[model samples]
Target: MRDDMDKVIVERPRRGGSWQGDGRAWRNSKEAGSHLGMKRGYHRTKWLNENLAPLKRWLHKQVHRPWDKVYAELCSGIDRRSTVQAHIFEHIDDFVERGAVMRDGQVWVSASWWGRGGRAPLEEASHVELFVHPLTGILLPNRRLREARAAQRTRHGTWAERRGDKPCAVYHVIDENTQWHRVDGCWFEVTLAKFPERVDAAKREEKRYDVLRRCMVTHGGAGRRPAPDMPTHASLYGRNDVYAANKRQLGRREVRARLGDDA
Candidate 1:
């Protein structure tokens, strides 16, 4: 409903292909395939094995079905230049063109698993909750969704936007699972997993920052006791962007040590 969000794209521009795929029209859309008694591939196995699966299992346990499977499948349909380009972050032009990906106040916002219906937020996560930028939530505004749908409509012209569309955003929750959620407002995508080698890894730095932010008291001192559960900094993620953002303030080794001297 609201627009006017971040233009804070990765400073480097995307030198990739157009986001032309929209699974809805593909002869093999998972949803379409379901009708014909088939299943569609969602995301790359690496993304699944490394990032989404564990969270999916937990969320499904709560909601009785994994919603990400649907969203992932939809994302899978978005056409790109190469396998690497299948990533969600690569298609900012579409976001910019349609405006689905907009800054919420100052935070970026986009639809998460909104239309898929939530399976559940992960449990037993290291961090129970996350926070938005207060003024910088990220968003996938109307145009972004429209462009995505237009991409989908290339094949799924039979369906309508108001029918399948939803408003969603990703979450940065840590604990039992780490996947997207279709919630109002902006939710940070937090994790404490191993560093991502997938993309340029601009976000790992951020994860390390989360680690330091979690470990230190307001005055920048370490906690006397580790969290009762999980390894040191077990909940912090080490993506590249987050890392680069805070590099001058901290170093990789120092941040990793917050997880532990061994990490």
Candidate 2:
């Protein structure tokens, strides 16, 4: 292998751009003593054969471990005092190309290895790939992952966004009901049985956008709004097809009787 590494398989192109011709043919044809560049050329060729060629070949042949294993190993080896580990962990994706398939709680490496190998199993794997830590099972949200989640949230809008002001003030009405709340672009659904308890819980947390409150006060007639901001009653409540269908089925008289005349 060392002898093979020392051998120069490809020669530099000659001045006229022909690889068949020797680069140093003209110089070598001259008297040996007259070849001023021979020493530099010899050392350069030696360095390339000894160091660079082998490195390039090795890099081309190198096979990376599965992403989950790589992540687990990296996290296991983390040391707060080591700058190298910190840098590697910070740009972990750069070291490995991730391609995985997760099903039935098992993660399988799908592709992206340089050398041939069978699919590997990942321990402690999440049922779905992306953003999940391999070992700890904690979600590590990346920009793409976050963007995808945001798109999903927008496409299917949360229960709160879908419900809008249909049930009146959601914060007031659903305060004691188990319903979803969209906060900071993420949704959390919790069950509460009392209004005061929900108020106390909200007070203890960081302030978040009150989407339900804004919708209620602005469109549900709890407060006056500018003409531009005010949407028609049908527009506000009819956005949900299921609710609209149910409302239509109930008829105005039945709806009024069940939900009161204001409904």
In order of appearance, the predictions have TM-scores of 0.17, 0.18
Residue pairs with clashing backbones, model 2: none
Candidate 2, which ten residues in sequence have the lowest lDDT sum? Answer: 240-249
Flag regions of model 1 displaced more than 4 Å.
Answer: 1-6, 10-12, 17-122, 125-226, 230-263
Candidate 2 per-residue C-alpha lDDT over 124-233 given as tens digits, one digit per residue, 9 for 90 to 100: 22121333434454333232323344455667676756778343322112332334333443333433221122335334432222233233222123223323324342
TM-score leader: 2
Q: Point to the candidate with the largest lDDT.
A: 2
lDDT of 2 at 222: 22
Local accuracy of candidate 1 as per-residue lDDT tens digits, 153-198: 4444423334664433223333533422212222233333333334
CA lDDT of each prediction against the hidden true structure: 0.30, 0.35
